[model samples]
Target: MLTLIQLILLLFWTSVGSAGAEKLYHRRDRSDVRIVHANQARVITDKHAAEVFLSRYGFIKPVNWEEAQFEGSASAFTDDFLEDFGDAVLEGSSQHPLRNPAWDGKDPDGASQSFISALEEFQRVSGLPVTGVFDGATKEAMNKPRCGVPDKEVDRNAAVDPESSSSASDTVNETDANRTATNSSVSADSFEDDAYHLNDTDGFDLKGHISNNTSVNGSHDGDMGNTSASTHQSQAGHRRKHHLATLISKNRQRRDVSERGYVAFSKRLLKWRLIGEGYSSQLTVEEQRYIFRLAFRMWSEVSPLEFVEDMRSPLEDVDIRLGFGTGRHLGCNQRFDGTGQEFAHAWFLGDIHFDDDEHFTAPNTGSGISLLKVAVHEIGHVLGLPHIYRSGSIMQPSYLPQESSFEMGWMDRKAIQHLYGGCNGRFSTVFDWIRKEKTPYGEVVVRFNTYFMRDGWYWLYENRNNRTRYGDPVTLQIGWHGLPKDGVDAYVHVWSRKRDTVYFFKGTRFWRYDSENDRVFTLDPEGRRYPRPISEGFPGVIGPIDTAFYDRRDSHIYFFKNALVYAFNVGANALARGFPKSIREVFPAVRRGDHPDGHIDAAYFSYTHGAVFLLKGSRFWRVAGSRERRRRLPLPRNGLLPHEEVGEQWFDICNVHPTALKLKR
Candidate 1:
């Protein structure tokens, strides 16, 4: 029995509660602002703002006051505009400022001409209309989220000069421009954060080390926007800068390579670490380190370099130190703009700083900026790679949203290899591991995995992913129990209607393997002990074989030793007639002098590609298969195809440093 006023109050409160709950739900479902910052929401509201933006990002240079007045364009270049321009550009290129005088008002019309040319260059790189005017499309692109690294590292006189340069519009078509514009609009308007989110407040000065105990939960005390807190932080930053200058003077003899092409590390083995104090609040410590390990491993897969995480080493000894920071967080010379626009920047052969203000997510979370992608791109910069302006390249200056399935592109691989050559090493053996499994419905399926062995270590290559397992180059003793401590010479798998057996060979001895048990068989059904001599197993085959593989079609084990091949018939348990032939006669090269003629490393019969490959050193040659036999220009029987580098086909089968062999899980 409620009164009318009481009933009305109850309904009103209920509606308010319901609305609040609904707002929370929508906020949780909303995607993060990956590329655009809220602070830059209306930064380019007018033409004057646009000019300031251009000048800040290395697009337009500051005009000389005397020359500008001589050209009668002094009104356009106000003192405040010039001052802001100088401050922004100086901040952007603190390490390497653009010193070319050609764009700094040398010609009377240089100021106006340079402005138009810079606009055209910006539009061209951004995939927008090549109109030199400051249009709406160009303004939108400038406001979008991008890497903090300056786009034009060197002079663009040849590229932007109207008289000398080719038409910028010739590269991008109308369809591409329209699609880019639409995608950009969708990214900016629909996906940005609606509310301010507090970032990790861990106080770290620019000194490349972290002060962990200074904060709780790795966060600072006051709000980042607090005026008093920022003032105190600014003063603290000044002290760190003075300390950094002292360190630079102590190491004054160190030669710095300014050119990107010559900027690679002189050594192959490099050390990297994420500063303890600079861990991101968005991800756990393990998640951040794992992401970094994978990123470094990706580069190692394509090149001869190897990366190891060294936690015990001194800060100065570490080759590359990475950390997350807000404005003036790390003792870095360059400051991060709060959220949006510039996400991260890297110093050549030095440290990397990420803007923690941005929402960074783990790999494949499908919401925020991908920390892994950003890491790989930054590592490229540290390794001396300049920003590549091509589609699908990870080194693009602007931040592109991650695809569902992304990988290191071809251009990226080749570019890195050009600086540091490919991964080159000899292998003891290489083979495909085959097994049979049944589905829940009792359907039998045959599966196989590829492995490469060197010394006592082996790599499990994921054919589907076109790379080795994340922490591969595992020791053989751990993977293949009861095998030789050093490594096996070859692996042979026999599959026939009457029998299925697996064998491992080392020196003069051979061991029978029980595939079902994942280990070598001590005693087989026939009462034969393991480690029987090769002479006893195959009567005609010699000891110390180079490599071997079983051919399913012929039901024979082809044993390779020196320059001859012994085709041993499994059913008859004897060498095939007219076998033990010269290697050249058995596997002829399709092209002259293009084969692993003799003393090969391994012979693999691949079920994936349905062919046989002869591996030697770092190269591999594919034997003629059924498809080759049916070709219009059919290859000769057992003809070896042109040899190609094994790394080119099987991506990223790299070795980890001995110290980093056992990961901390």
Candidate 2:
């Protein structure tokens, strides 16, 4: 007497089988499996099918021990910490390495040995150079998520009803029917009490989860936005969060650090609503909104996640909400000290409440608390980021102000990217994990700027002084060192024995910078100084230049705009007679109409190869004198650039070395 819905649930459970031996129906080829429901076949992956079954039965996805395994080798320093920092941070646990590995769980000796064995297995499984020791690489591998399971604390086992005995034929042979189910099923409604429960008396009880519990001293009358070096050093002395976590034997039940609680959204696009009114009268509503918008944008700059505002929705219905509150408001017992005490607090994938009593200031300057800075930190919490121990990180528990600059630190980027990866099919690990190939030439450092060909962004880096140092990032609007702010359309570095300069071109205008002198001067068509229109700089040249480079052998500059290549003598600053020839006419390998855009994006002279490379999209053509010699650079066997496959945006070339061009490491 089972209903149609009950029959479907039963069929799904039959397919999933028992807990310990969870069935993974998706093949390595990523093809969907076909299942018959009411005599109709439908295609779905095992994970999706499991999600559907859970939704139908109103049960949370089960917590499976197998999902806790770390997948790949950890190369990053943070990766090492996360991998080995299992459950020692749990509130009630004492299983840190400094302390005893034994916790409440049984098998003390066995657990200790198992940990070492597990570390070895992790190294081997992660494809690390196994030394059976807790090496750097092995530690990083432990931090990454595996088995499609996130780092968040998810309780309960998945709910899938076993099918009727008559439906035995529907079960697949690959599934283990005899395996044991570790956890019993619980109803979804009951999960609410242990989840996010808001009490009328006590404020919001977020299942007792406090992502980062960094202690904040009493309210400071002085400005909290000072980013002075002395202040920074003082703040560094403050207690920071540890990477410790609690672990209980093979069960591996764990918790993150006190000030480290990160939650992830089930969906990519999170919709949010603002519940309460303005927290402080120091700034206008528009100003506050602008501050919040900037905060959200700061995070979006690095992560694949996105947030949208849903103005016309209930706070509870929205994915997340923000508003101001006072003591006892919304059951929040933690009262705000009217002065510049606790700025605000937020829950994981939940509401953000500002202390309405705190004196707030929109600008970073001023004695009052910087509302913008606090907003940025609070938004980090709303976006599932816990309080990070790193000082430069936006997720850091305390705020250190930089006069005006607002950018996510390297740790922040790495952390978020680790969680959700980057957008636009980026973050490939193909080439990054491979061992470096020895360079034919001596070792050289490649300054791989991410904004290689980006329209408006640019940066400078120098590594000769033992350590890498670079100027702050700037956009086209704020030209650096006398360069035009309009944006650099094309650029090149001329390594001449007499004079070396980095040239930047925008529209018909160009500028040359002397790295030695730290001076920039406008350049005419010829290498001479003084600003002039492109037409005047290079006689007979029309339209914007896509790219330009000076050949050391010929001592002439070649300007590439669209399909046309215009050559100009450096000394004369005048075009060669009958110039402006089509690239297809000069280089036979370049098809006449190959690119729909009919333009060469970039070109550079390679001294190692003794040739010039003309870049178009993902492919490039290597060419020498005239129509005599030309050949397209070989595309990778896998048909992806090293940088592209390794999830990097820009290809790095160092010292004009051929080995560097090959990108072995």
Candidate 3:
């Protein structure tokens, strides 16, 4: 038998070993819990990100308050109440006008403040509480419809609603009632609907007249099917008629007889090839290919049109052929002056030719013509849009070197939508795309440099080799000063030879970020235009930009809003003119033209393989050259496709952990 001291020591060592093992087991269990929590949280985070993304880019204007009543619904109140509401909130009445306003009419920020004060004064005069909030009774009073501009006469023949009623202050008047009659007999006979068409000779015109009876004044349909809030309607009483006249005048313009308006290819799917002569020296072969691809993608996004590159041979029967030619180009009767006269031209179902004699710039050199701009315009002709006289139109008769690249004017979008129908689904922002990428364990954010944006919070991913750690989550606000009341739509980190800035897009505005100091800066510091309108900062551009990224290869930053992509030159603080191109044009194989359903959630360049990766839903693609070569990613191990519903895996995993331990034992 062993001695008593030896037995005691042996028993003590055994007990100590058992206790240590238990402690280690508990620690491992806690680690697994944390991992599981992160996975579970990903979906919630992504959902918020998606919502913010959608809100920023969608056509819906940000309302001041959800509870605010608008003018259209306040017919129970007197017309005087409506007219007075407009005068008080918009132009201001004599009795209750704004006082001591700081704004000089140029600064939007100052103007907003001045407008609020005017509202307060109006409320005080109207015997309501003097709150500047744009909701409830205040919103109802402010949104009342009124007459057009005093100086300019809106053509009565083109009027949408030829109402001549004076507002009733105390009681209705018989004369006013007759003048503001709602009968269909009151019509604008001189307003020919076909006159609004691009080319009457082609027997092509918009199918139906734009609706004139909507109660909401200054409300316009966005290109992406979102409701763009009317900024100009803030002043109009007879807003509908005024707005309609403007549209009609803008649509009716001079065009060459040969270039008929609203033409479209019969086939939804078509193949295009490059001639053996290749592209102009202005842009590299790759750049030209991308630009052309971009042009086609934009049209496809809004219509049932798809373009595929004919990689086989130029001799093959292709729907469209592209090449460079001078003077008497392509053996066709059409000729080019080669300098500034005519940059490029394309006939329906015919080849698109670029002027070889003129100097060209791929993006912009400020020394030569822009190839991308000319390509978009020529492609419009190929797709069946005649030259329009709209100031910002892509199909304008002459090439505008100063216009933003891929600038699809409102009229252009409406015209194309009229021809091919509209986009299959509502436009999705870049964030919406990322959220759709359902990872097996949920989407884990990747951090590069000092930024760590995820959903509504930001954190630092700390690691010393394999031991990974995360800092406390900080709520991301508009200016990065404190806790954010709401989530952001999209975030981008730009690092290139031109700029070192991060951008955060939210609502109708975006903020420039200073990563080094963890602060946000406005576009104009003196003006305090931190949350400026997208149009103000970027001419011919609207927001919210769904997602944005810096392309190291091209040294350009791209902003994706809805179905279009805008290229921004950070160094120049200028949007690369002739931009806001369609994604389908750049990447053709992703979807058919008849069904442009999906959107790119995230995009990144793979320097390792010299290709670009675009993620859509659960699948990701690797695209190279002008053509899109697609390879699908493997499905989840649990056999769940991204769109398919499946049972929860975390719960199943948790239940199995204990059993797994017992099995190991």
Top candidate by TM-score:
1
Task: Score residue 271 of candidate 2 by CA lDDT.
Answer: 63
Q: Candidate 3, residues 1-665: lDDT per residue as tens digits?
A: 98999999999999888873432212233431222231111221221222222222110112111011122222324445454234223332322212212221233333244344444543543345887544467544332211001101111222122121112111111122123312111111112355454321122111121122223322223332323323333333444334333322322221111222222454567677767675666667877776676556555434445677676854535777888877655554444543534466665445677777667676545556677677777777666555554567676554456444344555776676555554231111222111113357897553332223335543332222211112123345533663234656555556655455556666677776555456666443445547657666656557755656666656667766667777877667677877867765544443334212234454544333344444444344554433222333432211211221101110000011111111100
- For model 2, how does the per-residue alpha-carbon lDDT over 183-286 read when each residue is reduced to its tens digit? 22221111222322111011222232221111223223345453564354333322111111111111121211111222245456666655545344566766
| Tens digits of lDDT, candidate 1, 355-466 | 8888888888888898888888889877756566567878777767565456677667667766666667778888888888898999999888899898888989887867
Minimum summed lDDT over a 10-residue window in model 1 is located at 182-191
What is the TM-score of candidate 2? 0.41
Extract clashing residue pairs from model 1: 35-145, 201-220, 205-330, 205-331, 206-330, 206-331, 206-332, 207-331
Cα deviation of 59 in candidate 3 (Å)?
38
Worst 10 residues of 2 by lDDT: 426-435
lDDT of 3: 0.43
Model 2 lDDT vs. the true structure? 0.44
- lDDT winner: 1
lDDT value, residue 499 of candidate 2: 49
Which of the predicted structures, 1 or 3, would earn the higher lDDT when compared with the native? Answer: 1
